[model samples]
Target chain A: MPGKALVITSGKGGVGKTTTTANLGLGLALRGHKVALVDADTGLRNLDVVMGLENRIVYDLVDVIEGNCRLAQALIRDKRTRNLVLLPTAQSKEKDAVKPEQMKELVKQLKDEFDYILIDSPAGIEHGFRNAVAGADEAIIVTTPEVAAVRDADRIIGLLEASGLYDPSLIINRVRPDMVRRGDMMDIDDIIEILAIPLLGVVPDDEGIIISTNRGEPVVLNGRCRSGEAFNNIVRRLEGEEVPFLDMRGDGLLEKLKRLVGLR
Target chain B: MWEFLSRLFGRENEASKVAAKERLRLVLVHDRTTVSPCLLETLKEELLDVISKYMEIDQAGFEVNIEQGDDSMALVANIPIKEMKRALSRTKN
Candidate 1:
């Protein structure tokens, strides 16, 4: 397959776009393909910290875009993985510092050398969001199970559809099976009923993500998180493998059968 | 059952189905009809206005909202239907 660029975005904040980017980068890289993750959230950057390369970012996205540094000079090689790289955004620059064209050219430069160029977009329909998805061949819209999150995800989907980027897919994150069962929280069925994008993966709520993120290590490096496995499955699916979506909700087989039969 | 299963055996199609359904339900209700929650509030006021011409009514005891779908919002206004003259007589002294 040809090299692909994917921008992971959400219209609302705190829906784990950074975490998804880091994990997808790790998951794709671990499969032995060269992957570069770019932070398009220019001013408020965190992809470096999530990928654990915060202290090492001497040159950043702004530097590369503004000719302050060469493309290779701004690339921060991940410490643990040879296949993974991070193009950290310059923390001090405004969202308008880098034009959408500049970001597209940078990704074009990286696309030939990398298997997947994942852009971590800021939360909103503003300049940062536009610049992030400008060069992409695909996108993964991360959203939670909340109504507000789902509503914002719809807006992002609408924006993507309007942009003519049909490569956009959905990843419903932080789903609580208990709340879903009690009908208190929205289920994957409920979310899909609303957003209407092609589903990529479903990541269950896991505490390991917080600890790993704080330490500048993504949960992908940890083995216990099923969410990490789910991300890996997404990567495999991206690689053209047919993998069944494992029901992590531990849904009763009988319950599913009953739903299939249209019985309450 | 077999026909339906055969139709949706693949991964890509089903995911799109779920996404499409959700977007349709929320946006149509929110943006399409102009019958949003705010409009429902105004409708409540209008209903009160129409009824107050004939009788004395309790404003706080009523509630109005869109239900089921954006097009078919239910207006269930609970009124005591107090007699205007009888209620006014108690204050006439």
Candidate 2:
């Protein structure tokens, strides 16, 4: 049976689209699903670096599309998870290197082999964004609690609906529960009200995410940190399992005192 | 003491969050509709011209805005007409 293809996109940059793709792909793979993470952000590819598979890339998505390499040849297996693979993007090529129809064909080819194909879209609503979502069955939009990110997410959701990918789920990344509790930052409810999409998961602002990214290990692999557990829950939700959202509020009296002092 | 301080700070934050939500609500309505400020101005001007031909409209009282709903947006126009010139023409004939 063909697999489900989902595109991870954010119209704004640096809202954790690539990170979400890397972690979600690994999370699904760990749950015994064959997953492939495609770096659709050509010329600005960083999914390879995030996945720690930067050194193993001999052929990229463009290469496969241009007929320079077979589709199977471009897929690099993860160092830890054999079920997970990455179809990297070309660092030297432009976004136009792959057309929408070509992307559709590539995704169709991969659908037969992998249980889930997750595409990491480039920022902006241009050719790159178009290519990223060309073949997606569904979409998962990542955004922060900031107004700018949520605004861009709204535009992306509109674009997705216009393109016939309606009802795209949302992942509110980098949520500061402490700030939300104090009404300083936008809470999950605020974001959902604006985006008007079903919630997938909410990842807390965790230092462990930065460390995990630097180490080329997705936080899901450790599954100890708050962000890691969030990713795990997202995976379960994606698999049609009903998992309650994690309580991201700060714990203990000391934390409350620090929040009171405006220390975060 | 901590509760008191937090409540004091919390009031300011609550006001800001309300402001933020209001701002975002208005902005997202425009964004989803792809209605730029310039576009809205043009639309209002064109609507005024078209409506003025049919009646003597109160230009100062005229308003055109996008109103967002739960699942849709509407281009609402509140054109306050001062008098119906077309009615006068019909009566004169």
Candidate 3:
């Protein structure tokens, strides 16, 4: 069977949209699944950088779209995993350089060959975002457990529903369990209550993500990272497996403190 | 007493909740329904105008608020009897 086309999107920027894409792609690929991650941000691409495949990109998505190169030529195989490929976007061209129809066709071509086609959508509900979701089998809405992020996620949920795409799952990123315990930040339940989407993964705030990204290594490469485990859980959920949410902090005390400080 | 104690005990929590509810309601009202605050105000004024000509409206106690969450904006107008009495007294007199 062909793979699932998953669009990882968050309407708000700086809410870990790209991180979710990078880690989830690696997580699924690590599970022996053939995964292809398409950076749909177009000109403002960073999936290549996050995936550590920037040096390998001789041809990009635009190259394949414009017939400058074959799709295979554009696809850069992961130095770490053969099953994973990074379909990078051209940094020179703007988001509208490639149309949604073109993206649809491209994802369709890769569908049969891959187990998961994860597209990283640009922040904001614009042409870039639309093109990213044009061929999504399902959408994994990434958001932090903040009111602003959750509000934006709710808007994206509305847009997805308006577009006739319902049942999009939620990926709560940077959830500080301590803050959640203290009620300084919105907890998983609060987020779930607000977004009302099925939970795919609950990623805790981890400083290691920055270190890994700085090294051109995805957090998923490190099994010990909380974010990595969360990504793995999401991948398993995508495979229709039931994996429990991973609370980075062992106790809910922090969640309570966050609530006390009005950070939740 | 318990309510007061709970309220006092969870003062920070209550404040955050109140703040979250207020902000979310304000932001999401426009975000979900695409209705601007000016338009909503205009609508409220128009609604009050049309209704005031009839039985009674408590203009001071009247509130046109938008409920946020789930489907976003849910317009709720609350006009108090005291407001209607006050309006009726001011206008009729």
Candidate 4:
């Protein structure tokens, strides 16, 4: 059977789209599925750096599209796992270098080989966004809790619907539970109620994310941090397992207070 | 410290998230409808012109807004009328 193609997108930049892509793709591969992480950002590619496979990328998405290299030659196999590979895009090409039809064809070919193909889209609702979304069977909208990020998420949701990819699930990333406890940050409930989509999972803001990114090692490999556990839940959820959300309400004292005030 | 005290005192309702929610609600209403504040202003002027033909309306008190509900939306117009026209001149019945 062919694999599934899922595009990870957020209309606004700096909301962890690339990080989510790398972690989720690697997370799936760690579970014994053959996964391909495609960087569709073209001119401003970052997934290669995040995956720590930058030195291995002699070929890219543009090279494969223009018949410069075979698909097998362009894919960079992860050093950590034999099941995972990344098809990095060119850092020199423009967003218009690859067309939507070409993206669709590339995804089709990838679906035959891998169990999951995760496309990391560029920020904004322009050509790059369209190209990233064109080939996917489903979309995972990633957004932070801030007003600007959620607003852009709302717009991306509308655009996804307009493009015939409906009912895309959401991942609320970088949620600060302490802020939510203080009612200073928007909670999961607020984001869910606003987006009105099925919840995949929620990732907490972790300092370990910085350390992992610095070393080009995915946080999921650590498997101890809150954000790592959250990504694992999302990976399982994608595989159709029913995993409950983490109780990010801090320790016992705050938990008791939250329960007293009817907050979760 | 003040923030912690407010949370402890059950004053969480007044937290900044309330303001964020309200702001997101208003902004999304405009975004989903693709209607800008400028467009709403122009629409209000045109609506006042048509409503004035039948009744005297309070222009200052006239308001038009798009309110979002759970699973539905409403284009609500709150127009205060001074008096209804007693004589029907352009009545085509």
Scored by lDDT, the top model is: 4
Q: What ranking of all candidate models by TM-score puts the best one first?
A: 2, 4, 3, 1
Residue range B1-93, candidate 2, lDDT tens digits: 886886776776787677778778877766757677899999999988777667988889898898777757888989887998845454344
Query: TM-score for model 2?
Result: 0.82
Candidate 3 residue-wise lDDT at A98? 91
Off by over 4 Å in 2: A254-264, B1-9, B35-93
Candidate 3 or 1, higher TM-score: 3
Candidate 1: pairs in clash? A192-B18, A193-B21, A193-B22, A194-B22, A194-B23, A196-B19, A196-B20, A197-B19
Q: In candidate 2, what are the lDDT values of residues A1-264, reduced to their tens digit?
A: 899999999999999999999999999999999999999999999999999999999999999999998999999999988999999999999899899999999999999999999999999999999999999999999999888899999889888988899999999999988887777788888888767799999999889999999999999987657899899999999999999997766556986687578675
Per-model B-chain TM-score: 0.44, 0.58, 0.47, 0.60
| DockQ sort, best first | 2, 4, 3, 1
Give per-residue CA lDDT, model 1, range B1-93, as digits (tens). 765775556444445434554555656566434455777777878988877766888777777654455445454556766567434444345
Query: lDDT at A69 for candidate 2?
Result: 84
lDDT value for model 3: 0.83
Q: Please tell me which predicted candidate would have the highest TM-score against the true structure.
A: 2
Q: Residue B14 lDDT in model 2?
A: 80
| Better candidate number, 1 or 2, judged by lDDT | 2
> Model 3: runs farther than 4 Å from truth?
A248-264, B1-14, B35-93
Chain B of candidate 3 achieves a TM-score of 0.47
